[model samples]
Target: MPSPVSDIPAATPDLAAAHYAGKLAFETDCSDVRAAFAAGKVDFVLLDVRSPALFQQAHLPGAINLPHGKMTAHRMAEWAKDTLFVVYCAGPHCNGADKAAFRLAKLGLQAKLMIGGMTGWADEGFAFESQAAAAE
Candidate 1:
């Protein structure tokens, strides 16, 4: 196998960190996320970290609700081991996704924050499903 350092191709430690940060950021975005979902990829689960009320207002399709505050190792007992969770909240103004990811990490679960979140998805002209709409 190639040397791990040479494989990444970073000129400096700072640059390496920055590059990895950007690459990590892409783990969750509207277009890429949507494509992954439509293609039925099994590696990740979309997690809505917002409260049920907010999730009811609108949320990404197929996302499961798990409020950051209520998240704990025990609360995640039902989740399969090693399954990646893509966490998101209302919008950029909301830090719920980050908090949720942190909490999940504390419990040894893998989680990625969906950048731009609900607002970002809606801003891209994609539609969201609200409880009201679902009921109608």
Candidate 2:
């Protein structure tokens, strides 16, 4: 008897490859973000699509706080049309990142979701920055 995991036939290797490759175009993980920052190769903008208050509390070092609700074409125009944006929210439990990505797409910009969000960063034991420190 096929186990529950295998009950549904898996896609062929080629199809699986395509599926994952497609996913990579839309999402990135915390480790890659950190690596980019460490190597000074951060070519994309990292956006924290959470409330300003939440953002001030703690956020990724290089991330900018831009709540999904405040995403407007006028505001996004500050960046080049082809600029790539990487967005994240509180965690897997939040959809703010998805909303921000959708808004960016609507404005004809490219965006990818940073999987795991702040929760993922914390899970990776990455250091965080707060607005308080920036002010000091």
Candidate 3:
């Protein structure tokens, strides 16, 4: 019979370490993102791939709306080509984030998926600002 998965933790330390390293490389948690925003020293741009109406309702402090369905050359042309993008959607239940990441990749832009979407931020009690507020 095969042994239980938990019984082999010590034997797979390298695997665990590599997995964690890879995760950190591809995903970032909200706290680190918030800190970067507050410090005004970020290595990537934040993107929210939701409908304009939803975006207008509320979004991350610095996230710019780039609706997944409307992703196109004309829409993307204004943004810097080399900037790394961190994308999020409504929440984990929403696949808009993954779709947006795929589109960004197709456009040859570097990107990483934020571990949790906006819901994650709200769950952590982070404030969301409306587009109207941002306009001011």
Give each prediction's root-mean-square deviation over alpha carbons. Answer: 7.3, 0.9, 2.5
Which of the two candidates, 2 or 3, achieves a greater lDDT against the reference?
2
Q: Write the per-residue lDDT of candidate 1 for residues 1-68, one digit (tens) a residue.
A: 66987886657898889998987854578877888878987478888998899889988888788899
lDDT, candidate 2, 1-136, per-residue tens: 9999999999999999999999999999999999999999999999999999999999999999999888998999899998999999999999999999999999899999999999999999999999999899
TM-score of each: 0.80, 0.96, 0.86
* TM-score of model 3 (CA atoms): 0.86
Residues 42-85 of candidate 3 have per-residue lDDT tens digits of 88989999988999999998888888778787887777999888
- Give the lowest summed-lDDT range of ten residues in model 3: 2-11
- Please give the ranking of all candidate structures by TM-score, highest first, separated by commas: 2, 3, 1
* Clashing pairs in model 2, backbone N/Cα/C closer than 3 A: none
Top-lDDT structure, candidate number? 2
| CA lDDT of each prediction against the hidden true structure | 0.84, 0.96, 0.87
| Candidate number achieving the greatest TM-score relative to the actual structure | 2
TM-score (C-alpha) between model 1 and the true structure: 0.80
lDDT of 3: 0.87
User: In model 3, which regions exceed 4 Å deviation?
Assistant: 1-11
Ranking by lDDT: 2, 3, 1
